[model samples]
Target chain A: MKNIYSTLPVIGILLLTLVSSALPANKPPEKGGVLPVINLPIPKNPTEKVYLGLSGDGFFKIPQIKAKVVIIEIYSMYCPYCQKDAPGVNELYTFIEKNPDLKNKIKLIGIGAGNTPFEVEVYKKTYQVPFPLFPDKDFTIHKACAEVRTPYFIVVKINDDGTHQIVHAQLGDYPGADPFLELVLKASGLK
Target chain B: MQKIRLANLIMVAGMLSVFVTVSMAFAISDAYKGNIYQVGTIKPVDSKLVVKKGNQAPDFSLPSVSGDKVTLSQFRGKKNVALSFVPAAWTPICSDQWPGYNIIKDTFDQNDTILLGITVDNIPTLFAWINQMGKLWFPVLSDFWPHGAVAKKYGVLRSNGVSERALFVIDKKGAIRYIDVHDINKRPPLEDLVGALEKLGK
Candidate 1:
């Protein structure tokens, strides 16, 4: 079994190379091969001390702002989805604020990237964001969180029975938050 | 000989069918035409700003990257507004997206439209980046105050505090005549924008 496991991948690669060579020189296989772009190794999970930068207001951190559930909003100023989502985001803020217990358990943070500091400052002023929005100028936070782009979110929670397990991680465009929020609520044991 | 010829024909036909299927899958036909959607139904937003077709455009007093106040009414006189909502600057998508506006700078001018890219990013940041990227033609507006307020009005702000990649073609009358929302992964084809611009005429 061990020998088979070791040989399988190599055998598969050989088969792939053979099949590719058999095809007409002008026409390569339609799928399956190494991509052209430079690939970099990324860690699946972030280590401690690798924190998201300060929100534009200079407040909040990854671990410092402790909560049962942490809702991190990753966005850029000009994205239409981000713009369209602004009101929804405001509502999310309002919803959490209205629920003290949920608010205590759930912490909302916004991280703005890909824009200039001045741009971020303007965004901060215009939105009147109740929560802090961290600026990921260097993309260190983005890499640590494994975010591909803005208008997505990362929801994390400490499990109910303790042990502080990193229960859920979700990322998608705006409308994807409902499911993420549900997972967070479950992780926090909020029915 | 006949048997070999028959086999070859079948193999070629099979390959052709597979090629056609894949091409159709990747084709950029009106993939979004029948799939159009209102921004509201997709997410939650503030009720104050409703940007829709034929609706009198909401007015906003915001600053440009140059630190000048930009008002909706300013473009009401003659120039139509091509408000391209970008996700963020400096990222791969935004880098490609903003430069797209620059490449088509003359298109907006040819159509007598004022193209403005608006975002929550601030002026100094925008100024420096624009200088570096050299997109002097498309003024990136800052909806930084009241934060995402303009985007909220348009129902395009994502839940994450950034605006989605939404394009709005506002006519001289200040009505949102055309709205195209592309999948975040793709940019709306230039042909679509040009086609919409043609409709802006009589």
Candidate 2:
């Protein structure tokens, strides 16, 4: 009886170890956490520089747009969810472009986690993505952004002082481009 | 004596429990192996080159995504072949390479070349992955049964149970014209493949 009692603890510990190790490592960042400042290269144009930071809960600084609301997509070319969401992302880009007021005020870019320059190009060309898509080949940008899941979208509000803050963050695809644009506008305090 | 025998029985039971738990852990990892994404920059591999240009390409029949066996020899006299050996399916680099090739179907068609994508993953895994990219223009062959037999034959199989990210261009005469065993973690430039095809002169 004493032997069974001693062995029971050992078995229990083994089970616990197995359960803990099997769990997934990546999880979405908290909704209200500060968006880290990280240097990200421009996907379409590598010569330019871009920085992600926080404003008074708004404004992100990207190339071409000094102060604008930004929608940052943390994606991977190998992610099937990202692949499924490609057409919708393109639609979102189109919606932003067609709007006269929102076009210049907002920018969309994708940071492909662990994707090489060539891999990022393949994604953009294959999906006909018009927005700037950068490669985070080393996961440096990805880790700085809190290691969010693929197809993760973060809306940032760029402040007048050139700082930016994340207004909203979400995982998975939005219902459609219209709803997504509305969310971006609302998050940016424009709506 | 009875107490000692019971102690031994408990010890045996405890060891068995540990073994079972460890086995379960391994099984879980294997099942979700496709979901594990490796991050950061991977250094280029200095592969031990085995196959050289102008050698007759080794022939083999493997199961493809189309539910039919694909024999490399079948296309010997009919078309030039580009054998794309990716490390595995669902990883960062391998996933994008094939889709990138998908857009350049015209390039392959123009060169009279048939692109064959080979990976060490099985059919179901390949099917589930390729389905997400929509319809692929070329056939994706699995070297899973013999666990990368074809990749081994070509000398591109890595020690880690996967193939290196390699590209072999075979002329219609079944002679290897070009061989590019790229860095396992990097994507070979699309232009390089196209340039090689252009050099093939048809």
Candidate 3:
């Protein structure tokens, strides 16, 4: 009887360990939160001057767009899902570009999580990605964005003070270009 | 005593139920969802330089993903070879490394070089992972069976039964021109590979 009692607890502990080990290690960021400030190299032009608060860092400044809405894609060149969704993302870029009003008020960019400058260039060339894409080689930008999975999307509303608020944050690929553009347009109050 | 034995059996049965539940939960978890496993922060690997530059490259043949065997000497005297040894398939870093190479075929073509991607994973695993990313322009070779035999010869095999993320550039003369055993957790700069290939031209 005593042996059984002791063994029961051991089994319970083993079960707990196994269950916890299967849980996801990374969690996606919450929606409707302020965008994290991440310093990245300016796409295709790292040496360009950009201001961050009082500092004169040459790195790409986040949420620095002049538009009212900015969409940022956190992706990696190695991510298969991101590779598959590349065309859809391109379509979304085209949708925005063709709309004269949205084109002036909205901007999009891709941050290649863990991708080097060369790697980002290859991805751009392969997909013929029109929007500016920057390499977050060290994952500094990825970590700042809460280490979200590839193809994660963040639609932000740029505030008057240059700060931005995340209006919508999605962990996976958007359903399609139409709905994706709708979500961005609605979230940014353009619709 | 009979009653006590029955009670002990009940206890054992209860324990088995818990074990079964745990196993079932794990079986249905996200770990098996595609190849996206949760890997922690990047761990740096300090690799030893085993092969010297300007030395004759060792020759070996391995099965490729396309169902044909590939031999290193087959490319000798005709094309320059770049051997890329990644740690394992399905992991975060290794998964992205090759896909990035997929788009840089032009860089290799510009220098008249061919890339041979090698991993210790079996053919099926490599095939599934590579296919997930779309068709690759270069041949992907499997170093299984002998279990990282090629990586072992190059001294890039990690102690954990995987290869270190390494790149070796061999000239058309079958001589090792540049060797980079990069940090296992990070991607090697593309320009570095391009620069090495250009040096072989000169």
Candidate 4:
């Protein structure tokens, strides 16, 4: 009984130290709450709330990109990771083509948000992207989306009432179109 | 006899406590996440001269995919090594870019350069993926175990867990002569790499 009573303080001190050390000492910044958002205003492009722009071909309305679901692909032309993942992007484009329903539900747009507009244009031309790519030169669009990294993927879902919601956001690349397709199908209510 | 038994128990308990403390120290070191920079002055490893100019050179011993054994260092001195670093292998950009290195294996050989890729990924995952991708020519080095120790030593490992995609033209003396660190999203120009090699050869 004496030993147990004497050991209680040590045990309590150990537990307290462990618990205090385990907790984060500092809190991370809150999204949009701080003045950091003041750096760039959300893109009021009008067609797409944050991501949409005038179609390079001048055929479709900014938000009316041909699919029930839209993918806003954020990338810089010079990022090796982005270049390495270029084949997967091509594969995704092919994957969408193979699934008519999935294709109808999905629209992938390449956004050059990282590099200069000239560099982005050269990259798009070199890669021969099938979808329209817009250069977010000043990062207004990026600021609007609150994007933090290159090669980010944002899945935009169009509601029946013509409003949009960010259904999914991914920072890094994952292979195959299955994961992306599933998200699109789920968001768009496509069978 | 009772005193002897108690002495043995105390020694055993002391040994066990020491072992626990050592293991905990190791765990704390391993639990280190985020980037930790090398504590010394940044070393400049660019523009030096050495041997093995334009010839298939001899190989050396380095860590293998499992990192358990050293297998693929033989290509080191023989060919010009395109020391490529990617953020992580599984991500989209790394996935596409590593295979692109494979696509240019013939070109690398034409210049007598063996393209060596490095990342902080553990040997196990790297072994499986390299085998899956069938990247036969390039031997990917695992900067794991020591936890990107090589990258940290080289001053390329970012404050993040991964190292930046930096290209180093390591000469035959194993001294890096040309160093280029690109933006995370940018791929180093292959032409610039070739030019660096040509200049080194000259």
Scanning candidate 3 chain A in windows of ten residues, the lowest lDDT window is A46-55
DockQ of each: 0.01, 0.14, 0.16, 0.05
- Which number leads on DockQ? 3
Full candidate order by DockQ, most accurate first? 3, 2, 4, 1
Please provide, for model 2 over A82-174, each residue's C-alpha lDDT reduced to its tens digit, 9 standing for 90 to 100: 777789988998887798887667777888876677777778887888877877766655655545656678887777775667788887655
Off by over 4 Å in 4: A1-68, A74-92, A95-106, A111-152, A158-163, A168-183, B1-78, B84-110, B117-137, B140-166, B170-191, B194-202
- Give TM-scores for every candidate, taking all chains together and pairing residue i with residue i: 0.42, 0.69, 0.76, 0.42
Evaluated against the true structure, the overall lDDT of model 3 is 0.75
Docking class of 2: incorrect
Where is model 2 chain B poorest over a 10-residue stretch in terms of lDDT? B23-32
Candidate 4, residues A103-178: lDDT per residue as tens digits? 5666677766534445555565656666556665544444444434456666666556655656666665555566
Enumerate residue pairs that collide in model 3: A40-A60, A78-B96
Model 4 has a DockQ score of 0.05
Give the Cα lDDT of each candidate. 0.56, 0.72, 0.75, 0.54
Rank order by TM-score, top first? 3, 2, 4, 1
**Model 4 Cα RMSD, Å?**
15.3
Per-prediction backbone clash count: 45, 9, 2, 16
Q: Which parts of model 2 have CA positions greater than 4 angstroms off?
A: A1-30, A40-64, A76-80, A114-123, B1-34, B37-48, B89-92, B185-191
- Top-lDDT structure, candidate number: 3
lDDT of 3 by residue, B1-202 (tens): 6655555566566665544432221111111245566454444564455678888888999999999999999998999999999888877667667776777788899899999999999999998888777789999999997998888888887777788899999999999999988877566877898899988889
Q: Give the TM-score of candidate 1.
A: 0.42
Q: Tell me the lDDT of model 2 at B166.
A: 95
